[model samples]
Target: MRWLMLLFCLGLAACQPRPVKELPAVSASQSVAELYRLEREHHALSALADVTVTRQGKRWSVTQGVVIERPLRLRVDAINFLGQTLFQMGIDGPLLQAYVPAEKKFYTGMATLDNVQRFTGLPLALPDLVACLLYSLPPGVVESAQIIETAQGVDLVLAPGVRYETVFSSGRLSGFRYRIDDLTLYEVAFGPVSAELDFPRRIELDVPQSDTRVVIALDDIELNPVLSRQQFQLSLPATAEEVPLNEMEPVDDQTVEH
Candidate 1:
């Protein structure tokens, strides 16, 4: 009799309807161009991030400040916990310059994709880095984009083998995944929104290929601040040794070759 009762209860439970998950509505007519425009409008101009970088089992927690003048200009300064400037790097068009005050050495090289990756541990072009920092898509023409409804939110698959899966909550972008093929290039998550700019107060970038991760917490982040071209310049003393960026090794044993 107990077995018969259990069988009846199981049959009744199986007949009940399962709760359905409602996904966010995505427009079928949405184009990549529209999304790009939206992203550009929301991009920040200059930001000062308290960054923590972890790479290859080593960690460097520093305060980094970055200024971006779109179309191809960037400057970054990293200061250690004791408030000593560790390094300063600038990217002007195709030229890349970096100054290490500790070593009193200045390095210059072409800002190629590979070179930037070797130095920054980010496998992306300069423009791509700017976009990522601003929580926007890279500046380019997408051959096609497909919008699909996902359990998390909406996914936009761009042409040339790139995928962006976005998660939205409370009508704001919470995070996203940048993927190439089956490999995830970067995973970006946004923290609480700033009351002033409506932008995220914190952003996290995780790079799985090189085991690198960067967490940026913003303070006094200015959007579209007036910046002069001179701010991007890196000046070195006459006595400072000049070295080609490709030949400059972070350590004596590790050499990065072009």
Candidate 2:
């Protein structure tokens, strides 16, 4: 039921990520070395979060249980204010699956970036997906990173393939942009890192292309928690209507409340 509203709002607008810039030629200094250390800081994560999705000035949210591991394993369960399980979505390797309890429908598809964009309004591939959640860069990105030292802080830039700058103000981790070629895909702003857990307390994601935003406030985070195989597993139930992810077209907005 809650997800239904989110799906509707999604069709109204589009993924509205923040602005990203093209790559500039700058050399790395000791300042950029710090970025390398950020890579692979966490191999696994388990947490509970207040996940809010926004579109066209409309907001919807859910209490989400999140589990993620390296090499593309993920699980997310959305629970509403009434403690009802609204939906469940997960990824294992290249496989994607989701289930809606109210509709008794299950969705399945390949775990590609486009599918990710369609499902969560985030334009990220599996590896980069983990990077966004863990606040780390993809493997070897730092090796090819450039630097722009500002009076405020350092701006780390990447090469053509993925051209985005990671901003650090006053020697602290702030956030970054994500881009493909010349197009800015999205932007992320990070919250204060929890000294207790070494993990960020909140993450704000924007997809400017579609005007969509997502805010995740993480709580009770466990770094590298032991996750069971069953957590990433989902079976199509015989009673549920099996729907492929590609088939879930955006509903015509003429029928929705403007």
Candidate 3:
């Protein structure tokens, strides 16, 4: 089976799927068009979010201050209670930088998927993750989607023979699924649409491929915030030792959410 590399921004995943329903269907051109339009207009955002990661029944949750922009830029500042920095990560262009306060170490490397997975346990390149945060399709997506009517809704197949499916329920995007042959790699289910932002308030990114599930809850989300290039830069204390990513080992880091 072909590995489509359908990884979403920051290891988005699918949830435990309910039974596929054979419900009545209708045309969703307007809603679908609006979704795409929103994507096209989206450029940057800065927000505070609650991220929870569940792996094999163990859960880790944290609040993060996140800033991200288009064309491969991201910053995630994970802090502990009482407003202390726990870990910080940034990606600008091809460079990835992170600082762990507990370890008093600074990490830097090319923003490759393997290196990223080693540090964050998220098997995704920078672009894919940035797009995932935009609530848009990752790069290399074939825009010519084939919409098939189902028992209850429609499935938008983005690539032929790729088994990457985008499902819409009642004119709203409900989830994205990737299945190769009989094996399903993931199904990312979206929470309810936010009335103010018109986006999913939460996303359940259950990436079984990595044995990790991440659920991202967005409460104070702002779109297209005024931000500059310097926003993606990571700052570390001078005392922190700098290390290359290739020399590091993978850690079961605190993560969970799409």
Q: Which of the numbered candidates is closest to the native, going by highest lDDT?
A: 2
Q: Tens-digit lDDT track for model 3 on 52-75? A: 777767777778888989878888
Estimate the overall C-alpha local distance difference test score of candidate 2.
0.73
Q: Each model's TM-score, in the order given?
A: 0.79, 0.76, 0.79
State residue 8's C-alpha deviation in candidate 3, in Å: 60
RMSD of each: 4.6, 17.4, 14.3
TM-score of 1: 0.79
Residues 1-258, candidate 2: write the lDDT tens digits: 999999989977676775785432333354466566566567889999887777667766668888988868988887877889877888988999988787798989888776655545454678877777877766656666675665433554675456666676545567877777767788888899877787789999888876768889999899988888789978887889998877876522211111
Ranking by lDDT: 2, 1, 3
Q: Which ten residues in a row have the lowest lDDT in candidate 1?
A: 249-258
Among residues 3 or more apart in sequence or in different chains, the pairs in candidate 1 whose N, CA or C atoms overlap within 3 Å are none
- Residues 1-258, model 1: lDDT tens digits: 999999999999999999997755443234333446547675446877777767777765667778877767878887777878877888888898888787788888988776565544445678877776776666652334677667666677776567887776555667778888899987888888775786788888888987878778888778878878778778876878988977854431122110
Candidate 1 Cα outliers beyond 4 Å, as residue runs: 1-15, 18-21, 25-34, 117-123, 141-144, 250-258
Instruction: Provide the global lDDT of candidate 1 against the true structure.
Output: 0.71
